[model samples]
Target chain A: MLKKTALHDAHAALGAKLVDFAGWEMPVQYRSALDEHHAVRTACGMFDVSHMQAVDFSGARTADFLRHLLANDVAKLSAPGGARYTCLLNPEGGVIDDLIVTRRDGDAFRSVVNAGTADKDIAWFQTHAAAYGVTVKQRTDLGILAVQGPQARTLVVPHLPAALRERAFALKPFTAAWEGEWYVSRTGYTGEDGFELVLPHADIVALWNALLADGAMPCGLGARDSLRLEAGMNLYGNDMDETVSPLECGLGWTVAWVPEDRAFIGRAALEKQRASPPRRMVAVMLDGRGVLRAHMPVRDAAQRDVGQLSSGGFAPTLKQSIGFARVDAQASAPFEVEIRGRWLPLKQVKAPFVRNGKALV
Target chain B: MSNVPADLKYVKSHEWVRKLADGTLVIGVTDHAQDALGDVVFVETPAAGRKLAAEESCAVVESVKAASDIYAPVAGTVLEANAALADKPELLNDAPYGEGWLWKMRADDIAAVDRLLDAAGYEAVLAAG
Candidate 1:
């Protein structure tokens, strides 16, 4: 049986089309996906990301354990409510998963990982954590709600806990604050100002109803995927996997090659590939009117294979199709994508096709 | 179940074809196919005067979820492709059988339309699988 979230019934009430995603029954869309995409871009939208796993690491040596596991230095998350986006890499420098590690109060560290890789990630964490005497506990009790877009913060604040409203508004981007079990973060996958709330399942259901009553559109995974793509955020399996490293997938910035002595798990492999990376990533927009779906082959003018689309789809805001192509490190601009055996021109552009409800590319 | 208009002949691939008085045929995806495709964003129809073989992937319909290839129901010469889809692809979702008609083609053999499934037969295809 497919696992259902606490809000599965709510999705059904909204007439959502549920599909199995990573072994969980989840809403792909409610009505029109395009409208939901637009709603998030222009106003406010909410997504039930309860399926994603939030694992808490606690122990005396939690800081030291994270430093040894993640590619990005955990030392930067020095204070409570601090957060860092990093990737868990295998010894060979390939990405196991990408996650956000938040520095919680005391000896606890809260990290949210993709739903599809949660189980495997817990196993990996358990394997590496035992040496440092850390305990890996998954927080299945929490339901994550991401309210994103221009008005996300405004629309969500009035509903926050009475005491937390002021502090929640004061939280800076990439930061989080907690009051008991209520945690609010000023971070999002969409390139928009927003709040991601982690609340108890029972509390979350109430909030969902309140938000809907107040006109916050309840979006689904369909809009979430497009919003992230437009925001230029990488999806775990689609963009990077066990086969590719951070350098090859436009995430070299996430790697901390500094401090010199931090012997992270994949440091040696990253250092080896640093001088001459085999693959590189590029952002492409179809010059013509057509959708670019994942797995489509990217080619040079001569039709020689360059790479493949990691995440590709229609950009509702731009009214054009856009995607990310993981091409050869040596590959240059003016790429072509093979669609139905036809070579369609794809123009290379700087990433983040949209941010904060504005077009960037 | 979406509307399967009895006046139109259907293909297992979910295309509905209508035989016009001039022996030309009008084609578009069925209401069921449109519902399955979600919000249509772009539709690429064949250019006028293009020739198509039976089962040829002659056009494309792109939704937010994914892109689907629209195959030709029978061998035909394209008369005119819908110009409105260029600007408003949502027509496919809003009116799959009317304003969303993909193209007009003169069939190589008008008998090809009779060979396609009627509404009841197409309903059976939906039922079996």
Candidate 2:
């Protein structure tokens, strides 16, 4: 049976189209997906992200444990309220999952991981944490909601309790704050100015209702996927997997290489592969008709297949088809994607095609 | 509730058919089909003069969620396709029965339309699911 989130009833009430995603019965779209996609781009939108797992770690060795557990160094998060994006890798230098770890204090940190990999991620954390004398607790009592867009903060602050309103308003990008029972973080997957609120599961329904009353459109997984893709963000299973290294998956920036002696998991394998990476990830825009979808073959000018699309779709913001592909490290521009037996040329460019409601491509 | 026009004919595959005065039949997916498919992003209709057999998959309607095939209601030769959908595929969602029509085809046997489902039959197909 597929699991349902706290908003399952609300989604059904709103006439949402429910589909099985990662074994969870989640809303794929409420009304038309195009309208929801445009809402986040121009106004603000909310999503029920309660399925994502929140793993809490608290102990004297918590920081020390994470330093060894993640490819990104936890030392950079010396200040409270600081959050860092990092990759959890297996010993083979392949990404197990990409997640965000935020520092609540020196001894307590919270990490939110992808829903599909929650069980495996927790198992991995538990297995390795025994050596560090750290306690790993998956907090199922909490529910998460992400409100993203240029006006997200303005639209949501008024709904927060008076004490939390100011702190939420003052939050900086990538930072978080704990106001009483609520945890509000200025982080999002949709490349927009927004807050991801993690609160008690009991409080989410009322919060969702309040956000809806405040004109925050209820966006579903469809809009979420499109927004993230246009923002050049990577999907866990689609863009990278257990066999793909962080360096090859456009996540090298998340890997911290400083303080040379800190031997985080996968460091040795990464160092071994750093000299000659086999694949490189790039963002491409389709110049022809038809949608760019995952697993589509990409060819170089010589008509030789060089790579495949990791995540592809129509970018609502760009009003064009765009995608991320894993290509040969030596592959250059003038690329083509084979769609419906036709090899259509693709325009290669630097990533982050859109951000903060602005077109970057 | 989806709109099921009483005068039109439908197929089990969710496509609706209308016999035009010129004897060519106009085909498009049903409202329920478009709603189930979500926002149509790209559509590929058969080229003019292409031959199609009954129940054959002749067109593709792609949404962000997945790509669905639009099956031919009867054996026919494609007369014209809705070229407008190539640039604005959302027409399938906005007006699945009107501007969203996929193609116009001259049927090999006009009596084939009588063999397809009627409005009530199509509703039963949706209800059974």
Candidate 3:
């Protein structure tokens, strides 16, 4: 049986096309995906992301525990509301999952991880947290909604409580504020200005409806995927997994190499791999005909195999096919992607193909 | 709930065929098929003059989520493929039957088009699914 989010009924009521995604019955599109994509880029749109799991860490040793468990330095988050994006890696330096850990109040931090990796991540946390004296609380009672776009705050702030309205409106990117039971974070995966609200599951449907009534269109996973891809953001399973490291996935910046004395989980293997990085992730834009899709082989000038696409799709904003590929670390721009027996040229860019309703290509 | 014109003939594969005044058969995917596919992005129309066998895959229609093969309802020789779709594939989603026609073909047996299912039968196929 597939799991359903708190807003599942609301999605059905809106005539959404539901699909089985990562063991959850989630809305793929409400009306038209292209229209929804435009809504986010031009105006305001919202997504029901309740399937993503949030693990709360509290107790005196919480900060110390996260310092050792994650690749990024949690100690850098001195402010109470600061959020850091990092990867949870295994001992061998492979990314188990990438998540955002936010420092909420004193000794309390919450990390939201991928829906598909929730069970495994919880297990990994429990097994490793035995010595830290931290409380691992899986927040199943909460539902998350991401409202994004240029006018997202203007559209969503009015719906919040009066006291929270100003705080949420004033929130800086990557920071969070708690208003009673609602946790509002100025963060999102779409690479647009947005707020991710985590509230009680019982209140989700009302909030969804209120947002819809207030001109926030209900977008589904299709638009979500395209928006994230256009932003050059990595999708967990598509871009990286247990076998791929953060360095190879263009997430080297997320790893904190500072506090050299502090021993992180994957530090040793990562230290070894950092010296001789084998594969490097690059942004690819298809220059010829045909859509670039995952697993497509990337060949060099001499038709020598260089790499393969990790996440590929049609960028709705650009009206062109774009993807991320794991090519040889020495590989440069002007490569070819083998599509349906044809060697088509691809233009490599410095990622972030689109941001804030503008095309960077 | 999809639009199924009574004058057209359809196949189980979701393609619809209509006989033109010149006896050439015009083919396109049904509205339901396009709706299921969602926001057609790329189309691979069959080449003109290619001979096709009944139920053979002739063209490809791709959406962001998936790619589906459009099959020939009857044996025919391709007359002309819709050239506009090479640039604007979303025409299929906007107008699946009218301007979105994939290709026109001269049927080997002109009467073979009648052997395909009618609107009611096509609706039944969608209903069963």
Candidate 4:
């Protein structure tokens, strides 16, 4: 049986089309996916990301444990409620998962891992945590709701406690603001202004309903995927997995190598690959006819196979097909991708296809 | 519950066929197919005057979720393909049977429509799935 979120019935009540997503029965869309995608770009949209699992760590050595586990240093989380995106990699320098780790308080931290990789991530966390005397606890009682777009904060501010309302706006990107049980983070997967609220299970449904009444369209995984792709955000399995490292996944920036002495997992392998990387991930756009999907081959001039697309889809905001592909580090622009027997020219670039509802590349 | 028109013939692939008096048949995806496909972003129809064999892949439907191939039901000569879908692919999801018709073709054998399942039979195929 597929697992259902706390808002499963609420989604059905709102006419959401539910589908099995990463073993959880999640809403793919409510009324229309394209409309919801536009809502997030132009206005506001909400997503029930309850399927994502939040893991909490608390102990004297919690920070030390995290510093050892993640590729990104947690020392940068200088203040409470600060979050940073990082990758959990195996010793082989392969990305097990990417997550947002938040510092709740001194020696108390929380990380929200992807829904599909939550279990594996928890197991990995628990295994590495004991050595540092950290106690890892899965926050099953909490659920996540992502409200994104230009008007997302306005729609969410009224719902927050009066004391937090002002602070929420002041909350910088990649940071968080919390009061007792209410947790709101100014972080989101979509490259747009937003807040990801971490609420208890009992409070999620009520807030979701209130947000809907507040004119925040309830988007689904479909719109979520499209929006993130337009923003050039990477999907876990689609972009990186155990077989690939951060070096060629358009996430090399997420890896912190400044503290050379810090022996984080996969650091050794990454150091060796740093001097001469085998491949580089590039964001690509298709101006020709046809959609770009994951695993599509990317070829360079002379029709030599270079690499395959990691993640791809139709960008509703841009009204074109966009994707990220891991190609030869030596490869340059002017790539070709064959779709249904016809070779279509692809434009490659370094910047994200879109950011903050604006086309960048 | 998907709308299965009783007058139109259906194929197991979820395509609906409307037979005309001139032995020319109009082809379009059914409501069930469109619903399953989510929002249609693009549709690639076969060129007009192309000869197609039974069960041959002739067109493609790209949606937000995934891309799918549309197949010809029986041996036929393509009369005309839907040009509007190139500009407005949402028609596949909005009106799968009307203006969303994918193509019109003359079947090699007019009696081939008899080999196709009727509405009830198509619903049974969907139910079995």
Best candidate, lDDT-wise?
1
Candidate 4 backbone collisions, by pair: none
lDDT of 1 by residue, A222-275 (tens): 999999999999998999999999999999999998889999999999999998
List iRMS (one decimal) for every candidate. Answer: 0.6, 1.0, 1.2, 0.8
User: Candidate 2 on A1-361: residue-level lDDT in tens?
Assistant: 9998888899999999888888899988899788998899888999999999888998889999999989999899988999999999999998999999999966999999999999999999999888888899998888899999888999888878788899889999999988766899999989888999998877888999988998999999999999999889999999998899998989998989998899998999999988778898999998766789999999999988899999999888787799999999898778999887788999998889999888998
Where does model 2 exceed 4 Å of error? none
List residue ranges in candidate 4 displaced over 4 A.
none
Q: What fraction of the real A-B contacts shows up in model 3?
A: 0.69
Q: Measured by TM-score, how close is model 3 to the native structure?
A: 0.97
lDDT of 4: 0.90
RMSD of each: 1.7, 1.5, 1.5, 1.5
Q: Where is the poorest 10-residue window by lDDT in model 2 chain A?
A: A284-293
Which tens-of-lDDT digit does each residue in B1-129 have in candidate 4? Answer: 989998999989988899988788999999999999989999999899999998899989999888888889889999999999989999999899898999999999988889999999999999998
Supply fnat for every model shown.
Answer: 1.00, 0.88, 0.69, 0.94
Against the true two-chain complex, what DockQ does each candidate achieve?
Answer: 0.87, 0.81, 0.74, 0.84
For candidate 2, what is the DockQ? 0.81
- Residue A138, candidate 2: Cα error in Å is 0.9
Instruction: State the lDDT of candidate 1 residue by residue for B37-105, as single tens digits.
Output: 999998999999999999999999888987899999999899999999999899999999999999999
- Scored against the true structure, residue A35 in model 4 reaches a CA lDDT of 98
In angstroms, the error of model 1 at B9 is 2.2
Residues A1-361, model 3: lDDT tens digits: 9999999999999999999999999999998888899999999999999999888999899999999999999999999889999999999999999999999998999999999999999999998788988889899999999999998888888788788898888899999988777889999988799899999997777888988988898999999999999998999998999888899999999999998977999999899989768899999899755688899999888778999999888888888899999998887667999877688998988789999999999
Which candidate leads in DockQ? 1
lDDT of each: 0.92, 0.91, 0.91, 0.90
